[model samples]
Target chain A: MKRIRMIALVAAGTVVASALSACSGGSEDGGKDGSDGPVTVSVMEFQQSRIDAVAKLIPGFEADMKKQGKDIKVKLVADPLTDDQFKTKVTQQLIAKQAPDLIDIGDSLVPGWAGAGYLAPLDDYLKGWDGWDHYYPHIKKAMVRQDGKIYALVHDTGVQNLFYRKDQLTQFGIDTAQPATWDDLISRLEQIKQKTGGTPIVIPAGTAWGGSTWTEGFQPILGGTDKNYYSLETGKWDLKSPGFRAVFDLYHTMYSKGLLPVQDLENPNPWEPTKYVKFPEGKIQVSAQGTSGWKFDWGPQGKAPIKGLNEKVDTWQYPGLRSGDAPFGWSGLGFGYGIPASSPNKDAAMLLAQYLSTGKPLADQLVSSGAASPRDDLADVKPYADEPKLLQAGKDLATSVYVPTGDGAEQVAQAVAAATELIINGKADGAQAYDAFLKNATDLLGPTLVKE
Target chain B: MTTIAATASAAAGPTGQASPKRRRRRTWPVVLLLLGPAALLIVVFILAPAVYGAYLSLTNTQLTGFAARDPQFVGVDNYTYLLSNSEFLASLGRTGEFVLYSAIIGQTVLGMTAAVLLARPWVRGKGLVGAAILMPMVVPEVVASLAWASVLSNNSAGTLNRLTGLFGADATDWLQVVPLASVVVVNIWRGIAFAMIMFQAALEDVPGELIEAARMDGATALQIFRFVTLPLIRGPVFLYLLLTTISTIGAFGLVYFLTQGGPGGRTTISAIYIYERALQFSQIGIGSAASMILLALVLVLGLVYVRLAKVEV
Candidate 1:
């Protein structure tokens, strides 16, 4: 009995020891390798298509480093998740201090990550690069955080517009001219509804689409209004302002008037069918979409092959809130590579990011990945010259507004999207939904953090 | 083997008392070897994470910032916040309704009916019926969700809508119009097979003599099912309810793949709410707090199940 008890105890001990050892064995001492033998710099790219394109350029970077008498090993890690999931993954990595040396991020994510101190400012390094001056001023402005620090290198910029069915509009004898204001836009939608006899508009509006509703659906109206939601001078969230109410009112009108496809917007992929199937089939007459819609969504080589689509659809600027101010719409800052503060290979990472943001390699990657560069000089480049939609995107970038970077901007966007969804679903009217949204935001971020 | 050994040992009255000690002595090493790895896994994966999660619940830990590196403890602030937060509370209530409607009532009633019907020797094509009923449960959850989404889509292409249109009904988007009802039906279809198998096994063990005797005594078919069959399967019924209730409460992937807690939070069950808070929103403290609350609720339910099982015995 005594001997058996001893064996049992020994067996249990072995099992416990093995389990504990297995966990500890998986962790690596991966942070900061400054010593020279062969430095391994880890890069985390946000989207797969961009990463695959970047992966091809790694050898070029390595060869360039060799010419400069440096041996650097670049390890690229692609973010295999949706935008929301990517944010969570990056957060977990940052918290654990296991973050990669380089990170590919969107402009909306920049403010949140920068505020959390996960990003290393690139202003000093960017100044050393010759290509910095070639970047568009507005695009450059999008990368700077509230603290007046540039945290990322601008790679591509997305220009959004109101994409409409020109063939259908001409067929119906409705005016195909661009709307000068929100009321004009509304009247056009109403006309489309009366003539086309189907849902005339669709915007990204559901929780599944996350922050797109805020960026694509609501941001243009807010940008056109007299007062914006976030004030840089006071550093306060002003969602209760007239600007927010107007945006909400616009959605409420679209929903109440039955000018928007309420059912399609509620689908898991809110923008997929509306933009691809319905718009192409002339069912949805107008949609607010980005430059990608022209290049990768309905372009010649797009997933949905719409013959003569460029002729069928016409792109116009997001209508202004009133007739006086220049038309406005949200421009996605696309993806930019930045260094994490915790990265040990900060200098090397910065060098690589700078190289990837400029010249032939950057333009090549942009072309291969179906992205439009933020640089003005890239227009005369081969692929950009070949693609008319890319050239058109270049023109639209002059007036498009990127979301201003702030501490709680991502949260603000999500809150607005949720509020807009509430109204769109008929669960609450505009005013009640805005009030509830204000209360929710105040609860998450304290009342003092947000201004009423 | 155990039964035969016990019977033989009983014949040796004096040695029978000593046999238990010898048996334990011989069996303990084997038992320890078999159970040691399982216990270790439970401790390492489940218990450790749970304890750590509880610890995390008390802190103002976030995904990033100073909170990420060094989280500050704030006592029961997370718990207090959850109590006052209407969305969290509403999600908890919604989860209860979902489990009740989909698992307890829907799966049990339909599964029991199928089992009772198939148990009849006179029933035709039992093999075909059994396979068809069990097919949904056998399919991967993701595949099942995709199939259901395709069938119930609100588009002109959706199979169900296409069928409904033949009768002159409008091609309504079932997922949008009745999101919760659609999910509940899908879950019922998936879970019914498990419940049916459990009840079937229990009913087969029930003495055919007793059933025939009940019938000869002028007991109706419904009466036999209600008083006789149901009583015999009380233990298995409790077991099935316990299993299905816990699974339904914890279900996330299928519903998330379908609704994403969308159409204005109509289907935002507690599981989805917890995921959105902890993972998506990066509010680790709030997520952990919600997790603890869910764990406590599940525990209370398990205790109730145990007490009921004891009563049945």
Candidate 2:
């Protein structure tokens, strides 16, 4: 019995020892290199397919680097995550000081990231590069910080426009020509709603993507103000300003007048196929969408998916309130690439960013891949010039005016969402909702009045 | 001398049988041996981590930049901050509501009714019914959540809405319009099987003779059940209730995939709040404080149930 007990104790001790040893081994293996390996680049999962195309340019890039005898190998890590997950993951990595070497920062998040000191200043890289001269001034301004540092290079730009069904508009006795003003667009929608029992317009209001309605829809009205919504030039909030209140009132009126689908405001479906798909099928009439809408919504099962969609579907600018005074919409650059401060291979990452943004790579790969190039050198690129709709979109983004940076743009967005909810639910009238919105905006952004 | 030693050794017939006291003394080593693994596990995995977590809960620690960025000892500031946040308070309320409606009322009621019906000998294929009832419990929570989400989808093409459309009713956005109800329904469906299995096992242990005797004494079926069968299974019922309550409080996946705490914070529960604060907002200190509070709440509730129910092994 004594011998058996000893054997059992030995066996149990071995099991315990093995388990503890295994855990220790795992930690040691993970921490072994201590950041002394080939420099790895982190790219968004959305750009994974583009990485291969980028890899083809690496031979020339590496040959240039080898002349300097850096002897560094580059590896790309693609983090394909949805918007929310991507933000959360990137934020956590930044907070943890484990951020990927290269990050594809969307335009909306660039300001916040730069403010947080998570991005590196790219002034040194930009100064020597001739590509900087070719970039649009507004695109350059969007990427630069107040501290006189460029944090990101613009990778792609997109345009947003009002997409309408030509047949449906003609049926409602409305002009299919470009809208010149907000009132003209509203009148067209009102006519459609009166003539057709179907929803006149579909706006995504449930998800963040739905929030783009305000971006493409209301920003134009707000941008037309003398000081804009929030004047970066003045560094002050203009909450009580006429331009701000007018835009809020416009949103309230559009929602209250039954022009857009109220049910879609809280529709849980992230991508409401019914809205875009049904519009093309003659079930729904019109939509405000991005350039990608051609491929995503209008082509196959899109508005005129029945074979001649390109001819039947029409794209137009918002009409001006009066003759010859077209109200130009606000346009902003979309997303871009940047080197993270935590990157191990800054030189290689910088080269990759430059290569992707300049010359044949810029015009051939980036633009041909359905994105607009930031460089003016590629302004007359073939695919964009040949495609009429894409050409129109490119022009809109190039020439359109933009709103002055708003004070707390994110907070303003939240207020708009709350106001939309109230209007959709009929808890408050349009004027009342607009008032509440103005109050929230002023409270969050401080009062500096502007009116229409 | 040799003969005397031989006689003395022979007197001790066997070592263990030599004396009762000696045998009793040897049992201490056996007890210690038996408890060694459990004690070691408690010290390494449970007690040590718990102590570490408590230390972390008192400090404000962020995860980046300087290696020597010392953590500040904030005392109860984190807790105070969390309690003051309206979002956190709303989440607590939502969690409490979920636990009450879904776990306590829905699961318990449905589980008991199913158990009672299955317990009857006249119910054909009782074994098959029991297996079918337990099927949902065996499925991973995520898969169950996905299944429920599809069935209760807000779109017109969703299973439930499509079925309802056949009856000439308009489709309803189940998740968006009624976020809380959506989570509650899914939770009840997911958790009912667990309660049912527990109740079935408990009911099986109840003495049929006692119930039959009560019925023979001019008692109705309901009266017999209320008086005799219920008291016998009270312990198991209490156990199931405690388990279900605790599980419901920490429920994450079901609500996460279903409503995502959206249509404006209506379905945001305490678990999701902790996740967003810690992972999304990078507020580790606040998240840790919330976790500690949750732990305390669960512990206190467990203690109260134990005291009130007086459950026997």
- Report the number of the highest-lDDT candidate: 1
Task: Report how large a share of the reference interface contacts model 2 reproduces.
Answer: 0.09
Q: Residue pairs in steric clash, candidate 1?
A: A32-A344
**Local accuracy of candidate 1 as per-residue lDDT tens digits, B40-124:** 7888789999999999999977664323545779899999999998888989988998999999999999999999999998999
Per-candidate iRMS values, in order, are: 3.6, 7.0
Model 2 interface DockQ: 0.18
Each candidate's TM vs. the true structure?
0.88, 0.78
Q: Candidate 1: where is the Cα deviation over 4 Å?
A: A1-48, A69-81, A93-101, A226-228, A322-324, A341-348, A368-372, A395-399, B1-34, B64-77, B165-170, B311-313
Cα lDDT of model 2 by residue, B1-313, tens digit:
4643454455456662456465444443444466777777788888887777677777765332111145678799778777776668888999999999999999999999899998888899988887887888888988988898888876788999999999997888788778898889888877888888898899999988888888779999788778888888888888888898899999988888776666556787999888765654444566778888888988888887777679652
Question: Mind giving the per-residue lDDT tens digits that candidate 1 earns over A107-176?
Answer: 6677667777888888888888888998988777766767888988878777777888899889988888
For each candidate, report what fraction of the true interface contacts it reproduces: 0.49, 0.09
Calculate DockQ per candidate and list them. Answer: 0.40, 0.18
Q: What's model 2's overall lDDT? A: 0.65
